[model samples]
Target: MRVYDVEGFPNPARVRIALAEKGAVDDVQFVSVDVMNGEHRSAEYVSKNPDASVPLLELDDGTYLSQCTAITEYIDGTYSGASLCGQSPKERAIIHMMNRRAENGLLDAVGDYFHHATPGLGPTLETNQVADWGKLRKSKAIETMRYLDDTLKSRTYVAGDTFSMADITVFAGLAFADFAKIEIPAELTHLSAWRKKVAARPSINA
Candidate 1:
């Protein structure tokens, strides 16, 4: 299998971290997609993913898979050893819920700030019209983080005690936020501690 990725991006980092956790890093080939140069929008890349997204997985049989969550889930299911997802149905549901929350609340918000506010990769992104929308989305994202910080006070991980996909999603999202100069509020002590724990993981730097 081949994985098209971008360095220094959270979406691709998620997949790389997942591969490390699953001990499947050596199993697949990686093709770097340079986001900084607007390479993702090139005609060659557009043919592979019409939406022009990275972290796309192409199977040996020529099947293409898109989206970080779907691709990561497929990896976890197909490898089947040290599972990053929950073993039980209830656990899986909780993990999925937390993952969705992280994506919608944190990741999407960070994307808004990057694509709409910042002049990402120069002319590749439109920074003129979406500035206000980006600010609004950023405020919403921070509010969601505050709520998540409160929820995390009682639980060791996002979903429960185990290190599942939710934890990975949240960690990756928060890391992206950090890169964008967004800091976790001081009031979110639990979240800060959790972030530290995730950061200390060896695979996170992978």
Candidate 2:
């Protein structure tokens, strides 16, 4: 298998962390996508992934997969490790629910604010700037932080007792928030603490 991505990007980071968690990072080939140069948006790249997004997975059987969630799910299922996606029906549902919340609320929200309101990827890529909508999404991202803080007060991880893909999503979301200059409130102690704990994980620390 091969993974195409740009290092340090939030979405790519999620898939990389998932591979690390499964101890499968060494087993796969990682191809760097020149996102800064807009290589990901090129016509040839778009053919394989219509979304033209980084962190694309090309399976050995000649199947191409895009989207961080879908790529991570494939990696989780293919490798023998503690599952990132859940093992049971109910667990999968809960993990997916929380993962979506984290992705939509924090990660994607921060991304919208960065690309729309700010000079994200410079003028070359961020052609459609909507300051007002981006500002609104920035507020949404912060609101999600507070919600996550409250939720984390009771649960050890985002979805439940064990660390799952939902936890990875939240961690990357918070990292993206930092990069986008969206401050996670100091008053959200639970969130801050949980972030610190997650940061220390082998998958992240590595």
Candidate 3:
């Protein structure tokens, strides 16, 4: 399999961590995408992924998969490791629910704020930005942080006990928030504590 992404970018980091957790990091070939140079927008790149997003997975037989959720699901299913999705129906529903919340409320919110409100990736890539929309999303991101902090006060991980894809999403979200200069409030001790534990994980630490 070939995974196309830019290292250290928030979304790409999610896939790398997932791959590491599955012990499949070395199994896949990584192709770098130069977003800053507009390589992702090139016709050659868009042919494989219309979304023009990074962290894309290409199966050996010529299948292309984009989006972190879909790519992570493929990795979790194909590789032998603790399930990142879930085993039972209930677990699946809960994990997926939490994952969506983390993506929309935190990750994407921070991304919107960065790209729209701030000078994200500079004027070349961040054209057509809406400051008001970005500001609104920034507020939503902060609200989600508070919610996650409260949620973590009880559970050990984002989606209950085991560290699942939801946890990866939230971890990447917080990392992006930091890069975007959106502060996670100091009062959110539970979130901070949870982040510390996740950071120490072998997958993330790698």
Candidate 4:
């Protein structure tokens, strides 16, 4: 399988962490896509991913998969290792719920703030920016940080006790926040501690 992604991007980081956690990082080939140069918008690349997003997975049989959650699902289901999604139906549902929450509430919000409020990649790719909307989303991201901090105060991980995809999603989100220069509020001590712990993971270091 060939995974088309850019290094240091949050979504691709999520996929890499998933692959590492599943022990399948060495099983797939990594292809770097120069998204900053508008390579993703090119007709050839758009033919594979209509959304023009990175972290696209192409199977050996020529099937293409986009979206981080879907790609992680394929990896977790196909790869033989410890499960990242969860083992039981309840755990799976909760993990999915928290994963989406982290994605929408934090990661996507931080991305919106970066692209709309601030000059994201560059003027070429970040066309039609709305500073006011981006500012609002930035506030939303900070608010979500508080929510997550509170959530983490009671549990060791995002969904429950185990280290699941929800933790990975939030970790990637915070990494994106850091790249965008969005500082985590000083009052979010739990979130800060959690960030430090997650950052030490070998998957994240990879």
C-alpha TM-scores of all predictions: 0.93, 0.98, 0.99, 0.97
User: Which lDDT values do the candidates have, in the order given?
Assistant: 0.84, 0.92, 0.96, 0.93
User: What shift in Å separates residue 7 of candidate 4 from its native position after superposition?
Assistant: 0.4
Scanning candidate 1 in windows of ten residues, the lowest lDDT window is: 120-129
Which segments of model 4 are wrong by more than 4 Å?
A: none
Candidates, ranked, TM-score: 3, 2, 4, 1
- Candidates sorted by lDDT, best first: 3, 4, 2, 1
Per-residue CA lDDT of candidate 4, range 4-31, in tens? Answer: 9998899999999999988889999999
lDDT of 1: 0.84
Q: Which pairs of residues collide in candidate 1?
A: none
lDDT of model 2 at position 171: 95
User: Candidates 3 and 4: which is better by lDDT?
Assistant: 3
RMSD per model, one decimal = 1.5, 0.8, 0.6, 0.9
Top candidate by lDDT: 3
Error of 1 at 199 (Å): 1.2
Candidate 2: worst 10 consecutive residues by lDDT? 197-206
Off by over 4 Å in 1: none
Model 3 lDDT tens row, 33-84: 9999999999999999999999899999999999999999999999997999
lDDT measured at residue 131 in model 4 versus the true structure, 0 to 100: 95
Question: Total backbone clashes of model 1?
Answer: 0
